[model samples]
Target: MRTGERRPTLADVAAEAGVSVALVSIVMREAPGASAATRQRVLEVARRLDYQPDSRARLLRSGESRLLGVVFSVRHPFHDDLLTGLYDAADKQGYELTLSAVTPRRDERTAIAGLLQDRCAALILLGPLAPTAELATLADRLPVVVMTRAVRHRAVDVVRTDDSRGLQLAVDHLVELGHRRIAHVDGARWVASADRRQGYRDAMRRHGLEEFVRIIPGGSGEEDGARAARLLLDDPPTAVAVFNDLAATGLLDVLRRHNLDVPGDISVVGYDDSSFSALAHIDLTTVAQDIDTMATLAVSRAVERVAGAQVVHRETVIAPRMVIRGTTGPPR
Candidate 1:
């Protein structure tokens, strides 16, 4: 607890509480993701370890102008995961993230404008929906690093997962489970949705399940999955690969409500492997985007550009991995 000694950190508290650093962060920030019991335990661990977050202090000590503005969607659980990593990355580089959230009512423009007003040293956008020209315009003003989405603009640095590969991985897993009547619930019109959709098609064709290729209209939220589930009920597939975990949760809920035993009746797969996927109740088999690598590279690129370093590459694509969980099973 002494000031001169190395201070306890979120990692310390997480280790003590048998939880993840991300969960510790959520507890520390009083975020909504944690359960009340878990929150109490995390708080006790923090108090016991004297763990205090120095991120804000570090930012203030460094300077107000050293902030990295980050634009992300509030609705995406994956964004929350990346935010935790982004904070750690920024902290390592003596910078802090200033976040602008995109809600249902607030558009990306509004989020970006808020960051521009903050006068951050650089901007790192997470799966931004802005057009190439708009991103280019923003890049002309300052360094911009887009994460979790691909862009062709020379001025922008993109750090994203091979989203297509993520879908392919999911499809492959389901196919390996001897599922032929496999369908996909796609991320409709989202920036990364197109690649994910195509990946599904490619994976299905590669497995000679081309005749089984069916795409259900889905989106980035639980509601979208819930709606898609209704359609799926008419003629259910043996397995389904969803666009993302958020949507997958919705689909799971609806399927369960209809007395369908997951994996026994219809196996479900999701992308992003967001924290909730690992929960015992959800236990979603999913494809994981490399959040740590993506965040580190995104921040690294943004910081380098801010430091006036020469751009080496315009984009970085991290690989995806499949997480085998209880949600997936051989066709019944």
Candidate 2:
């Protein structure tokens, strides 16, 4: 070696540690087969030589891209909050998340297949629209954790709210306020929406007040709520339980335009206690879902699959609490 020149190599580290070049190579690249003592010795020798492994080579050998694929349906603002929770949890668990939105143009199957080709360990689908049979088929190859959807497949884990109970809470609140002539603004197309709508109907029947209930043609947004409100201009109910906070905001807007008093001349309830639900001006009564817990549990379940654990077909249903605000009162 020249006195003024210096270049580090695996052979140099092997000579310094009294080990073979093969052993030094394993330690330098952090391969799985090295013994702890041998690894420590090789690491010490490399530190003396100031050796750094090639990151590109390391990634190729590990077969891990260190990325988790996350798919969202419709990209609602509430989903943005859930994404924040998911990202924070993923970071703490030492995984990076790649996001893709499923739209009318880009279908779910194509987007998910692209993610799999990129070597993502698992896929998290939020409020998926795919058929249950299709999801079960996908689970045969890779790990799948669904948020806001239910499945009984052995390969899928579900984290969701008790949609039935949430709706019952809404109905019970209005019923307690003497609201017999109540109505429901339903988001009927989604799976969760169907459950909530059924729960509303079931609760109404239990209270023997089904005769007075009205079913409004609505959806999951403020525009749908506004349209439903317009339809109610001629024959308004004493109170209404909207599909979500966005719809409730729209209902409030239409009611304000028509000079109807909230919870006085009419009461209103909404689901999903989103940030917009608590504005100083809005002050909406809503059902609160634990976003942080759901996100954390979802990631943990994904990790269990990645670890080769014998996971069961698990479905978790967390009950929602009703957040009573100024939007509800005794029916007039």
CA shift at 292, candidate 1, in angstroms?
0.9
RMSD (Cα, Å) of model 2: 7.5
In candidate 1 the C-alpha lDDT for residue 212 amounts to 96
Predicted structure 1: clash tally: 0
Best-performing candidate as measured by lDDT = 1
> Could you tell me the lDDT of residue 104 within candidate 2?
67
Once superposed on the true structure, which residue ranges of model 2 sit more than 4 Å away at CA?
1-61
In the range 1-332, model 1's lDDT, one tens digit per residue, is 87688888878899999999989888877779999999999998888887777755544555757899999999999999999999999989978789999998999999999989877899999889899999999999999999888899789999999989889888888877799999999999987999999999999999888999999999999999999999999899999999999999999999999999998999999999999999999999999988888888988898899889998788999999999999999988
Supply the global lDDT for candidate 2.
0.84
Residue-level lDDT tens digits of model 2 in 1-332: 34686777778888999999888887766678889999998898788778766543445467865567898856365777789889998888887787887776988888788778767777888888888889989888888899987777766789998988898999999999888888999986865888888889998999999897688988877898999999988999998998888888999999989999997888999988888889989999998888999899888888788888876648888788899999999976
Report lDDT (CA) for all predictions.
Answer: 0.91, 0.84
lDDT of 1 at 144: 94
